[model samples]
Target: MLLLEKGIGGKSLLDIVKVVHLTKRIIPLFWGAFLSIFILFLPGRVWAIQNSYKVGIEDVLSITVWGEPELDKTVVVAQDGTINYPLLGNIAVAGYTVKEIDELITRLLAADYLVNPQVDVMVKEYRSQKVLVLGEVLHPGLYILTGPTSLLEIISRAGGVSDKVGNQVSILRSPVEERKIKDNEHASTSVEEKEAKSILIDLEELLKGRDLAKNIYLEPGDIVFLAGKKDTNISEQQVYISGRVQKPGAYEYQKGLTALNACIMAGGFDK
Candidate 1:
């Protein structure tokens, strides 16, 4: 009551309430205007995002030349990150950005061949960024990594781990990771110092419980291997023949091994 009596500039409670009400109305107007401007600029933002994607190996490209159907053709990037075009034979398109390659083809054709070549390059399919997911997961194989994906997300993508964490889920980031690091490092690391890096993830910690830290981001070409269920592995493994057997104890497990064969391996069942 005392604070209300001593309101801003000796204003009464009623005056303060009216001012707050006015402020509430004005805030929505400002927000609406800001959102309108932001919405208007969204198309440009999307265009920029699309323009920033670089071309890579195995990516299908839809390239067309305006007014010249003969020169227009869709091509896939080769293993060496190159494309075979009419004028440019075996042009290296890998590593080079889409815009760069577009300008290059345009310039090359105009210089020696076409008077004014019009080139349009668009990625029909992106195949360069992918990872290999193998082992105990339900669906394990090559997974396309469209964006930043965590280990946990990948496990879910592979239908989760076989059995929580019976076996370790390891990521073998070999020459692929090493090559990228060397490329970004400006060759700071020598060949001798460069080594393949590996990461072992505990799926039990993640699936069975909360261990957010175990979720690490994966890179293209990384191999994520999840081991099979420990219980299944144990059972499907060695077959033991003991009680009343000639030679008891554990014995090697061979497919289609009957009880008699097991007894034979154990020096024949005891009479």
Candidate 2:
């Protein structure tokens, strides 16, 4: 007589064993496929994010060379976007990725100083990229930009807009000629020759996500001004009725009020 234990749902022990065995095989396949996808996609996404950051002026950098103690040093990028390295007097590192800087230093060192040099670079202090936020903000001041930052992001960093803010915001940006001069180009061009341009954004549209294109990315040295409401209530708005008026004081301003009406309201110009 063969022994057959009954299991749940009127299934035999043999049937349950078969289901468990199938599950064991399927689980590995599922995990393997999931890991394959993760491995294939995750690295590229991470690399793209890392490569997007570029060095800028006033940024401090820590650089090292494998097997060369003398080549390791911390350098601050100058206003001109350059750094003085050992055996390499001055190198332009602004607008370059860490990996690019590594390759650049390695190639230069291998040219005459070292053989098969391995180099590494890291940002010690991010002081270069900055923007100024002013007018009608909770905290009006300067902010640092670590990466690609948008106008809305900076405003949030400054504690968001104040309650008295208006419906629009203005951005004053450096002209193209000035930007080119900063990049070590157009040596003869004067920054004063070109006027900075102003960009107005509808705050209502931006905050509501109605028009995302208006939420522009902020650049270094950009100034963001949140204007206050010009059309405030009568209490907040006043007109000076003085000199020849009986009530030689500030009176509440009313729309369409003429000089004669103002004088009449002030008791007919001092009687």
Candidate 3:
């Protein structure tokens, strides 16, 4: 009986070893098949991720290298605007477009580790970009922007414009520096050259879909102000209708009023 039990135990141990070996061989094949499907569907869904978006801090990224699945990783851009790549340490990826980062990674890998590596970059999450929506929006606050968002899309995200919102909307933007200067060329100016700019959009035309050009893309830090029913602040605007007019006097200046209308408002032109 002891001999039979020992023989049976040895056979079971051999079977267990065979099963573990089979699992080891099948795991890589399963992983490869899964990755093949992911790569196949990636191009089809490429339109969902705008290629025009620039990378930013805290944005999650999925980077993959074909034929080398071990290099694929999902990483978040650090506050220093960089990502830690395998064997490359920290590489600055933020403030750069994904295409640029792809080219960079491809070049680095080819130079250091691989030969003619095919790389793909995709943003898994856009946690960096944001826009502030205020004034007359049902949910007036900050909104996290994910893709190519138009003015109308942002309005909708804020629960659409409130009933009190007027036909005009104002977008306040901050100017960014266009060029980089070397240390020797840099000037010691107390004030930055960036200036505040305001864009006026005709919301009435935009919402009606009559003029799509009125729809504008929102940038980071852009403030959307919806004009309400309150009167616009006018700083002493008086139009004088004096020449050849009966009872000529000063009138309140209003937009779209022609010269004839102005004269009529000042008691009409003398006959």
**Which candidate gets the maximum lDDT versus the true structure?**
2
Candidate 3 lDDT by residue in tens digits, 97-204: 787778888988898799999999998888776665655556655667666667877776766665555677877653432222122111211213345467788877
Tens-place lDDT digits, model 2, residues 1-271? 0111112111101101111000111122333343344335544554553355577777888999989999999999776667889887878777677777787888889988999998888877877666656555566666777766777777767666655667778776633222222322212112332445667889877766688798788866565767656663334445444443456555665543333354457675232
Off by over 4 Å in 3: 1-48, 175-193, 231-271
Candidate models: Cα lDDT each: 0.54, 0.59, 0.58
Clashes of each: 0, 0, 0
Ordered list by lDDT, greatest first: 2, 3, 1
Whole-model lDDT for model 3 versus the true structure?
Answer: 0.58
Instruction: Report the lDDT tens digits of candidate 1 across residue range 129-197.
Output: 666565455555566654456686666666554442354677755343221212211112222223345
Error of 3 at 62 (Å): 1.4
User: lDDT value for candidate 1?
Assistant: 0.54
| Model 2 ranges with Cα > 4 A deviation | 1-50, 176-195, 232-271
Residue pairs in collision within model 3: none
